[model samples]
Structure formats: C-alpha cells, structure tokens
Target: MNAQTKQDLLISIPNLSGYDSETRVLMERACVSERGNGPVAYGACLNRQIASLQGAPGIPNLSGYDSETRLLMERACVSERGNGPVAYGACLSRQIASLQGAPGIPNLSGYDNETRLLMERACISERGNGPVAYGACLNRQIASLQGATGIPNLSGYDNETRLLVERACISERGNGPVAYGACLRRQIDSLSTLPGSQ
Candidate 1:
C-alpha cells in the first residue's frame, strides 16, 4: 500500500475494531506475517484486510469507503499476493455472495485462487460431499455461467468462467446418476437469499 493508502486504511482502523468477531478475525488473517515485511508485504496485508472489511455486512453503508476497500482488496488478490492471497480473498468472496444474519454482503470486484477454492468448497459442501476431499474432489476454477443455479460473487469475471465452474463442481461430486436439477435449484435458492440480493 502507498503512503496515501496506508493513511486511508489507518483512518478506518477504528471502524474495523467495531466490526463483529468473524469480520475482525477474517481481516487479521488477510495480512502476511513476517518480521522482515516490506512495502510489498505491507500492501499484501492491507489488501487482505480491505477485502475482508468490504465483505462485512455494514460495508454498503460505510460512506463510499466500500469502493476504496474493494479496490485495495482486488489489487492485493489479483496482483500482489498471487496464491498467498487466495485464502483470505476467497473467504470474502463467498461472504460477499451471502453474509447471513446481517444487513448485506458488500460488493467485491475481483477474485483470486482463494475465492475460486471457496466456490469449489461451497459447491462441494452443498452437494453433500460432507467430508472435504483434497485431490479426491476437484481443484479446478471456473469463471462464469449463463444459467447456473447459484451465482458466484465476482463482477469482473467473464461468462465462460461461470459455466466452467458449475460444470467442474458437478463432475467433482461423483454421486449417483442423478440429474443436475437439485443442485442448481439449491444454489439459486441460496444465492437469492444472500446479503445484497435479499
């Protein structure tokens, strides 16, 4: 993060402290831990924090701070952290789509490997693939789909990516010869109830 960015985030720190427990834990986890952290390191940390904060329920009402936060989060997830930003970034992505028990999930504009992993895991979980399987399931990432039951949370992804993910998730289920109808229905139902959507 630049000096200006740092100052901006610092100003929001007090607001962050007011967030609920889950958001606070998530924000802290976005930063990379190192005794020898540099500007790049600081940027990574800041990006993760911003991503988590933007996904919080109250972000929409945060007085335009949400846009600044979303930009920083995207820069970190898509550019700086590479794979490292995935875990934190994806958490915010999934939450962005839903964020239960609150006002709404804020709009997050970008995605990373972490967020893709989140989609896969969520798809798998909903498919009743109970115990998460590492290599046993799927590790692929998809971007967009036309009629996917449950829509993903990224606005910048192309349509093809969405379809790919939906297909990949289904293949990973490895269940009986059932149709895809139920899965799609559940996904649609779930997404319609997400924070912003609801």
Candidate 2:
C-alpha cells in the first residue's frame, strides 16, 4: 500500500493504548503483512499476532506489553476453544476497557444473538456513554487519519479542482453530503478570484 493508505489502516486498528513507541512500531510492522485486506481481516491478523505473542517461549507474562496488548492476549486465552459465557463476558469487558478511543466496540457478530446482547450490555455498563463517546471519538479519529493524507496543500488548484478537494476534505472529516456540497460551493466562490483561477 501507499504510505497514506498504510497510515489510514494503522489509525483504524483498535487496542493501541499505552504502547511504547518501540512496541508500537513493531506492531505496525507486523501489520504490514496484513495490508490490502479490509478491517475485519486486519483485526483477525491482529488477534493471531496476539495469540502468537502469548504463546512464545520465554515471554511467560505480558508485563512488558501495553495494557491493550495484555488484555487482548487475555481475551484470546479465554476464548480459546471455549464457549463459556462467563469467560466470554469477562473477555468482552477487558476488550471494551482496552479500546477507550477505538472506532467502535469490537464486532460481536461471531457470537450468538444472546451472547451479542450480553456483550453489548457489558460494554454499556462498562462505558456509560459508550455509543456517544464512540461517535465523537470516531470523528476525531477520522480527522487525524485524514490529516495524515497531506490534503492541505491545495495551493495551485483551479476553482474546479479546489472545489473537489474541499468536498473530499470535508467529507473525510465526517461531515454530511450537504456540508460537503456547501464546502465545495464556498471553495469555488473563494478561489474563483485567485490569481491562477481558470
């Protein structure tokens, strides 16, 4: 993937809290192998990596890892070959806690309907404003993700190009289509008088 796309994928990965710079870099490199796949595939790759890290010899404990990594490892261990509700619920709780600013809660689609409901309840109890916080956090995350795409350099664009660029920027910031169209209109109006406007 290109650098910008790679960065966007990285930002969308959950469970990164409390990682040291070096460990974070290592995990990013690990994710390189999982690129080009969508988010669910990437998450599966991450879970596999967590399982591998948990099983490696001489790393008996995950004390050196971040809390997020440690919690993921714990979840992996708990869910291994077991469908026990208590263990699953505990794992879900830890997953929720580890993902404070994640895009949203981890997908529970793999669970049965009943289990999914329980997990949602557990998440809600763990985070009182879970859905609201998730929306706000997702917006901030999108802004940061797009900020890495180097979209701010619209210096030499003509009116049409600037309008398209503005629409893209506003949309990537999570604004609605109406806002995007308005932004495009405003950009077209403002840039029409610029020195190089066509």
Candidate 3:
C-alpha cells in the first residue's frame, strides 16, 4: 500500500422507507426537527399505522426495527384482546404528547406541557365513569399493580405512559372501556401520591 493523494469522502444519509417507516420518520423528527410540524406528521403517520395495524406489516427489502417496533408498540397499545393486552396504545398517546407534535396543553406539571395534560387526562379517566378500562391499560404498565409513580391512580404509570392510557380510554366501550377504568384507578392512586400532582 502507498499513500499519495487524499480522497474526499461523501456520506449519504438514505431516505427512510418501508412499513414501520413511520418510526424512522418520527425519530428523525423527534431529534433533528426544529418545528412541531415534522414531529406532528410523524405522530400522525404512526397513529395511522397503529389504526390500520394488522399484526406487524412486513416491508419487503427493508431492514431495522421500525416496522417491528411499531408492531410491538401497537401490540402494547392498540390490539383488541380479551383480558391480557399490552398497554402500548396508552404509551403511544403519551409519547405523542411528549414529542414535538402533541405537546398537549400548557401550565401544568412534569417535564413539559404534554406531561401535565397527560396527568390531567388520566385524572378524568380514573375519576370519571370508568375504572375497569383504566385497569386494562395499567395491567401492562404498572409493575404488579403494587402501585407506581406518575400514574393517575394507584397504578405507577410514567407520565407519557399515563397519557397513553388516557387517550385509549377516551374512545372505547364494553370490556375495553372497563379495562381503561381500571387503568385510571391505578393512575389516580399513583398520582394522589406524587410530589406536585398528588
């Protein structure tokens, strides 16, 4: 090997494509993006993917965990199950609020406006006309239902996660709604002990 002329290197940042493509888009928007619009788009895209979610949509010739990750997230938050379902749907909502897009309302507690809104929404969900529904979300969120921090009730749901449950509970019925109510109870109890919220 001999050293002679110096070569200039050009790096190409490829475009994000494929199914869970929304995840890549969202992450990019979440980090480098300066405006809420970009993040908002990512959020909407993720939401659509979640809504039309059929297990995990497989993308041909695509690599990475975007699709799989989104699938896991949906499984945690979206899927329609009998009694055992992941609380990812609630997590998604909270995540949206925490992100650049769904910053939620203002003048509250936690890291940002989104966190506060999430807590308040949780309160409404728990204190409202449903405890079972809240439980459904919490079953997956709370660690053994022994009580958690940042949750709305007796549950220990993180800020963003609590908001996720609140969002899920907002539009559901029957067993789904009942589960949400339980989740809310868990949150309510948890929040009741928080430093500022409790």
lDDT of each: 0.42, 0.47, 0.39
Prediction 1 global C-alpha lDDT: 0.42
**For candidate 1, lDDT tens digit of each residue in 12-94?**
34344565554455445444462147555565565556564453443222233355334433433343233333354453454
Please give the lDDT score at residue 104 for candidate 3. Answer: 21
lDDT, model 2, position 190: 74
Clash totals, every prediction: 11, 0, 40
The C-alpha RMSD in Å for every predicted model, in order, reads 20.3, 20.9, 19.5
The TM-scores of all predictions, comma-separated, are 0.23, 0.22, 0.19
RMSD in Å for model 3: 19.5
Worst 10 residues of 1 by lDDT: 127-136
| Cand. 2 TM to true fold | 0.22
What residue runs in model 1 are displaced by over 4 Å at the alpha carbon? 1-16, 33-44, 47-198
> Where does the lowest 10-residue lDDT sum fall in candidate 3?
4-13
